[model samples]
Target chain A: MLEGELLGVFALTWQAAVMLGLGGLLIYLGIAKEVEPVLLVPIGTGVILANVPLGGLTEPGGLFAVLRAAGIDTELFPLLIFIGVGAMIDFGSLLERPYTVFLGAAAQFGIFGTFFLAYFLGDGGLRLFDFSFTDAISIGIIGSADGPTSIYVATMLGSKYTPAIVVAAYSYMALVPIIQPPIMRALTTEAERRLAMPTRAQRVSRRTRVLFPILSILVVGLIAPKATPLIGTLMFGNLLRESGVVERLSRAAQNEMANIVTILLGLTVGGMMTARDFLRPETIMIYVMGVVAFALGTAAGLMLGKVMYLASGRRINPLIGAAGISAFPMCARVVQRVGLEANPHNHLLMHAAGANTAGQIASVVAGGAALVLVPFFA
Target chain B: MAEHVVEAPAPGKILRVHVEEGKPVAAGDRLCVLEALKMELPMVAPVGGTVKALHMSPGQTVEAGDPLAVIEASP
Candidate 1:
């Protein structure tokens, strides 16, 4: 009673110190390098808080734990983010170019391919890793290149590596600029990247815009009911934006709601990254497998885009196919930059955006499919 | 001088008024920035002109086709 513990230093273990260092690194990257600062900063701060000795931030009833329960564990934050994402997207480009959906679908093969590898390594037959079928599926969902979908699937499957999976998903997303370009360059040639796409897209009707979200929900929900929550929230947000009746509500969903949920989600995810859990070899393997899955997804998209380029009589820029990984404006921007590099006068932003938006829809569909398939196999 | 009016593309808030009344601008110069659907879209000068009037200000909301500014064509 006379000497109650004062500072957390005496309780600080090497693992905690490492985690704290890692947290500092994340904060550095967020502040100095500006790598996904919106996410990394909060996550980095959470990591520091959780790793501090006697902090109890990750313990039951703690702030991070509470946030995790309310948002990540319940899968509310990701879904809420989807509404913001949906409202923020303008699907007119996708509507004008429907065929790009094929590229999006093709990109999803990475999810399945990575699943098989992860299963074989962990639980399927090889047992090379500690990944159970559930764990493998959770890791594989990283290929979706979608943060919320990854969170939802990992949580739904009850994987032990949810933290790793979330980190991988967001990290890879932030690296989209660096990751996709090399693959895009490797897959296409000077001519292919230089291929000029039509500048103007056919105007999409407002009725069509309204109907697209509704029709998508029905079709997707009917096909993969498990994906209903993920897809449902996304389409709901899109519908709110497209309906032309609720401007204030849509804006709020896009800005305020998105920002609040993102902060909660990022912090909770970071809080989960305690050393004992995150330092395992399995976690390392998850990170490795995540890169593989993302690369495969990107390659598959490029391959499909090449096919479309050939099929469309060379009118399509295969670079746009690389945009099918659902990294949103980043992927589209990458494609546009590559296109312009090959041909200074060419403008591929809209065309790349078309495929990019389709990729967004397709990633959601793939996530729904994973929800259905993971349970069937696991 | 010929009068040219720039219109808003969609409903959004004016995030930035890049030019003021009587400022000379060339074609493609950004006159203002509009925040819509969480995207920052710039309203560019449609033609070489002098900004005659600014119909909107930062933080003001706008609707599709609402006039944003008026430019007097330069000859």
Candidate 2:
């Protein structure tokens, strides 16, 4: 009895053992497959630590618990990470092609659509799962295709399935290259994909560049007060970068601040995934819904692209619509690749980057919109 | 003789130059490949012409509107 009491092996439950294996798999994907390694590696480590029998890391007052309370609960980590993301992103592309903003907005239909579907499956209609309005909203934000926004919105809503939601969001985001292409190809004809956009965007004045973040904050904050925190921090970081005089602060936000927050946030998120909490039918459903959310978002964007393509007399390549997800340059690259396959000389990078960056803003706005709507409905 | 200056469409690194100075090229011929935002953007000839001058080489970074090549349009 003494040996059994002392030996963690003897105390290990099947769930814990399974969680340990999952942790190993996450780490393997990070290292071997090189998918979101920065977050996944730390998260995998945290999962391993949390699952070890009697580690107590996830117990009350333990490190994981403390970090969770301080960072995830308070929504500090995701907000700080936004600053880094803002600093790293150059709005130049978006500024060059302002019309792509519509495509970005259209892509957000996925979030609302998936939310309704998830809700209908649960208490809202079929009584299939335990997904609350808040839970459904949290799951749907995965459609935003932005990890920080996913974490921030999920945490704020206090959803029980945040761990599953976070995992699905990050994992599917890494799979954007695979998820977006087929849908992009299916939606656009060869002629639509072959259309080439003008390479040069009209020069944007420095004054306009400096004003963008400020005006964006004012406009978005007024429209969706709940989004103020998420958009505010992001724009502030962009302000720091575009302000030109604060290069040092911008660099710090882009690198050190972002890195530190990512580490803590990743670990906290991973530690939240105890096998008992993570291994549920709802978790599997969340993963499936995540793919649905992405497809819906991609399709919505493509539909808008087709509309704009017709409106523009085929000047616009509908493939750039796929870039309307928040996966950043990956979505943009996919658009470029697809456009090239249709016509080798067709380069859609600039236009796609415009839409991709716009998608970042639109995703945040959608997250804010959910934050507002979910509570009212709940 | 109408001379057209081909400007870099976007800021990026020149990955490969497909034409030499004095090389005759048709419209839409690839002049050079510019890599920007992790995507390869092939700058093509806007009009059929002789390559009068190549202003950029592989590995050189350029900004939007920077002259990439000078094309002397054929009569």
Candidate 3:
């Protein structure tokens, strides 16, 4: 009785032990594998802290709970992070090739496709799992490949599986390098991959740069009002960046604010992952659906790329289509690498960056569309 | 001699300059490596020629259309 009262070891459940191990594994992946060490490391530490018996960090009014309430529940952290992301992004490439916006829109099919499958397997049809309308939408958002958008959507929808969804979103995003290459290789012929796009595109004017974020806000907000908050903050940051007069504010958003919020957001997300909540069949299914979402998104993008390739008389590298998944620079880098592998002379970086940035806007719109449409259907 | 000016394809930093002024190069031969958006882009010579002048150096930042090198077609 004394030992039980004094030692946390005596109170530790097998579930908690498993969570501790999982937390350790996340740390290992972050430190050793260098897979998004910035977020993963903080998340891992939070997981360990939350699972420690008697720590109560995740209990009512605890540190994790307070952070979660102030950040995740209020949906402030992800929104703030978007500001940072916008400041970091250079839409010059996208402006040079506005046609790539279709590629961005094409990739969003993954979100809807995964939603349909999740709904069919759950409350909508098979009744295999407890995924309700909102749960399915949250799960579908894992395909957004943008962590902030996934969190914002999942939280806005009030999905019970927010922790699982966020984990899957971040994990799969880091795995973009591994998941995309096989699909890209299988979909494109050697000749298609080797196609070289013109390196020089029309340079965007300073006026166009400054007008882009404002115009995007007006267009996207008018079309998807629900996404206004998400897109608003994002474009606001970009406006600061392109304004040329707000260098200090833009720098703050990109560096100091982004770093601080990332730490809080990562830790809160990890703290939410209690073993009882995370070790469920539905959680496993969410992970599976995440892979499906990414694959489907990649496939859809590639198909459009193929269409564009033929339309352009094979001048457009179909590989650039794969960058339309909103994973930002990572997807663009993958396109460049794969293009190089197929032909050393092919440089697809600028073209891929265009599609990749377009994907960023498209994914935000898709997230807004989901927020608006899911409730009407539910 | 027909002189051709090779320009930067995008805004980035020169990571390495593989050619020196007065050196000969073939079309498609690497001229320098540019780092942009966290990826390395290897800039290549557009025509076979003797390098007449270089406008870029390692670690220098360049904008799109900034001249990186000038090449004179081999007579």
Candidate 4:
């Protein structure tokens, strides 16, 4: 060993320095700005650890490598996260207003629309980026606004941009408050936003609550078998929560299981963000396209909301339509806030929640559809 | 007869109050409307009695143990 190469900081390259800075930025955003603290914190730590020269964190037989293989590559982590998500969500709103499912289905327009645009910019057309058909489909799923579905689909499709997709999905989810409001306001007039919806829905029976997960799994599985694993695990967790027979399991799934999987998933995603892999033109394009997909999804949901409003003789507030972006309670809160801004007494939370929860189911179906269609066309 | 109190079934805002002092109510009568998690749940009378006192009003926030109303048990 007569080499003069340094062992640590002296051996770090400019690329590693840049990645380290990016890692610091992520950590700052998480801690100071509170931008998705749960995810960004671990992701930042993973990025820093991976960028240290000779750390072997990402090398073969190393920690990051083993994590990637065990969780992401196998697509187990995302599915497990779904179980936790399912346990936490209460679908009573969606069950009360069954028709809101249409808005949810319509919001998926962004996924297909973005897929087409992404394909056109990549190998399918201009060759500006290296996006294959699978990459484009996985990228398009950012419109789902769901982190686990995006991770599950991207990992299953074997996209090289899994890290970018995951980051974009989580980042945009946090930005739902900022990104969705302008679009919602632009789509509806003052009168439309001020329109009040029924504050109370008929109380759902306990038996109906118990049956919902079972029925959802059956219906969704029958239509989209590829989505069965994603939908099945999600519903299974929901069943555990609603069944009232497994309180301990439900609590664990909601709290302990969810937290553990989130940490592992965030770290694995961040570990993939080494400079050589992440600092690329394609990554930029993916981020840009992700925003477009989210916007288009919101717009499509609004359009569907307008249609439903007109069909309902203007009883349905078009503001609730924006909640169909599948960003869960955040999107619902945005809709409610916008509604209150228009009319101080207008409480649109229940209606917005109906559409928001519907989007959750629809996005999963869209993910499943993409899984099936991409292979056929590619 | 001793007075029996009815507490909030869940933590939420009282959207509506359907009973008043001295109102005759049945065991299964809806006493008030509590909004929680976007669903409006009826806080019903657990036992038939005369409404003695109402502790909550519209738009009031209630906790699980917060007494909503008091009923004088029928003899």
Give the number of the best model, judged by DockQ. 3
User: Whole-model lDDT for model 4 versus the true structure?
Assistant: 0.87
- Model 1 chain B: ten consecutive residues of lowest lDDT: B35-44
Candidate 2 local lDDT, B38-59, one digit each (tens): 7777778878989999999999
> Model 2's DockQ?
0.46
Error of 3 at A290 (Å): 1.2
**In model 4, how large is the Cα lDDT of residue A8?**
66
Q: Per-prediction TM-score of chain B?
A: 0.94, 0.95, 0.92, 0.91
TM-score of chain A of 4: 0.98
lDDT of 1 by residue, A120-158 (tens): 988798898898888888898898888888998899888
Stronger candidate by DockQ (3 vs 4): 3
Clash number for each model = 0, 0, 0, 0
Estimate how well candidate 1 is docked, as a DockQ score.
0.07
- Best of the two (1, 2) by DockQ: 2
lDDT of 2 by residue, A1-378 (tens): 786668999989999999999999999999999998998999999999999988889999999999999999999999999999999999999998899998899899888899999999987999899998899999999999999999999988989999989989999989998998889888888889888787677788888988999999999999998999999999999999999999999999999999999899999999999988998899999999999999999999999999999999888888888888888888888888888888766778878889999999999999998888765679
Span of 10 residues, lowest total lDDT, candidate 4 chain A = A1-10
Score chain B of candidate 3 by TM-score: 0.92
> What DockQ does every candidate get?
0.07, 0.46, 0.47, 0.05
Interface RMSD of each: 6.8, 2.6, 2.3, 10.5
Best by lDDT: 3
lDDT of 1 at A272: 95
Error of 2 at A331 (Å): 0.7
